[model samples]
Target: MSRWKPHVAINVRNLEQSVKFYQNLFGVEPVRVRRGYAKFDVELPPLNFALNEHPYSEVGALNHLGLQVSSTEEVLAAKRRLQEAGLATFDDMNTTCCYALQDKIWVTDPNGIRWEVFVVLDQEDDRVPDKQKILVEQPAVACCTACEKHSPLANE
Candidate 1:
């Protein structure tokens, strides 16, 4: 575990909803929860993420990005491990996020940034970032009502 692993933080529209979404997606419940912050000590595939509930209208651009795991069980196991570590964990069994079939967990650190640990079971090549057409969903959820609302991007 000496190798450094990158940790990312992002903002969420709703803490409770985001918490629930991650718990179900990753298959682990949060070990800690507060006003608008959550943390998960995710293991298995190895990811560090934090989630924060921000005013839907006040949210900003994504801070960083992430990669999905290979299995639903991996997501679930990660969730369980995180829960055991006394961190907040959320499991999304069969939900789609960021344009991929994912089982995931989410958390928010003290700084009010969001992070997600997920496994991609399937994908849709909708957003082509480069010459390689990899499946991807929109960057982040739209805060304004005028933005396109997708289930994965929406506040669960």
Candidate 2:
């Protein structure tokens, strides 16, 4: 078993601009940069942070937060724990998302914040297509009924 790290994914208006900003803030360049995405594997603070370029009007600047586990088993264990606790979970196995092949589970907090538990299986050269990206982005609105029921914003 390996250590888990806090992962934050932010939606940016421009990839290049956001990348430069993060580079200055973190004082290190991104570990991976793709067509519409960039990742920073920061060690001092232990963060697996990423920037995703998207239309600001469609989705706000903040994307999703996550825990990057070392293995798929860890992800499944998290899914089971969440399910047992009566929380809704969405599982994506070997999905090519965010320019990586990953096994992940998504759970929304009572406040409607989405948390992803995932392990990277492999990396891909090309960026995720818009159609597929949309499906991944809207899991709360599209799948998580529990989130909607508890979300204050969902009502208004």
Candidate 3:
């Protein structure tokens, strides 16, 4: 069996300010920081959390939540289990999103909260030159049917 980490992603009005605040609160700097996103892999309370810069009016503070799996096999297995239980699942393979290349499968809980089982394939450097910023676009539509209809974050 692989380790499963609880993931929480939030929408922040300001990435830098939120990152600094969380660093102080958690007493550790983020392990990963990108242009508009940051991740804190905290061990004290056991959290795999991240923040993404977004206008508050578009989506409330909470973005989405997920489970970080160690391997693609785990993602597939989880997807299978969810599907077998009658939940709809959507898959995105080798997709570049959230500043990283990931393979993921998404599902929506009854309350319309989107959850994903994903494994990172590669992460882009945080300090990439400004010229490269223009080429980066917001991620395509998310993979959960319920979330897509109810949450603005699903299109981000």
Candidate 4:
């Protein structure tokens, strides 16, 4: 519990549906659940994932959410596991995304939020050397924005 874990709280249309989706995705039951809310303290990825039940119809222009893994094998493994769990997955192998070469798999939550488990193949990618400049020029969402739009689950 020493290292910082990323906390993501996304609004969902139905708490129960989201809870079931996450349970299959993370392979763990939410540590806490209540009316209009649910929380899964994912251990393997060290994420504080939460869902808020609301009448939130607009998903906003969120580019996506992701888990950065260490290798292509790991990415493939995730694809296999998720697919086996009856979740459809999309693969983007050796693509230059977020200005870096990466291998990743994409999945859409019941709420239409795109999630990716990716591995950066080229950390020193010269696409955007000035990290701060990239941040200033490109809308943060632009990084992987196209990735989600082109995903098979884009409509889902």
lDDT of 2 by residue, 7-41 (tens): 87777677886676556444478999999999999
Instruction: List TM-score per model, in order.
Output: 0.42, 0.45, 0.48, 0.80
Candidate 1 weakest ten by summed lDDT: 143-152
**lDDT of candidate 1 over 48-143, digit per residue (tens):** 667777655533565423336776676667677657656664445556555666666664432333445567677776555667866445446532
lDDT on C-alpha atoms for all candidate structures: 0.56, 0.66, 0.68, 0.80
Clashes of 1: 27
Question: 145, model 1: CA deviation in Å?
Answer: 13
Q: Which regions of candidate 1 are displaced past 4 Å?
A: 1-60, 63-67, 126-156
lDDT of 3 at 35: 92
Q: List residue ranges in candidate 3 displaced over 4 A.
A: 1-60, 127-156
Q: Show pairs that collide, candidate 3.
A: none
Model 3 residue 45 distance off true place after TM-score fit, in angstroms: 11
Model 1 residue 126 CA deviation (Å) reads 5.5
Best by lDDT: 4
* Tens digit of per-residue lDDT, candidate 3, span 1-156: 277767877777778867765664444789999999999998855788888877655544445566677889978887777676566777877777776777887765433346667898777666878667544344666533323544435556
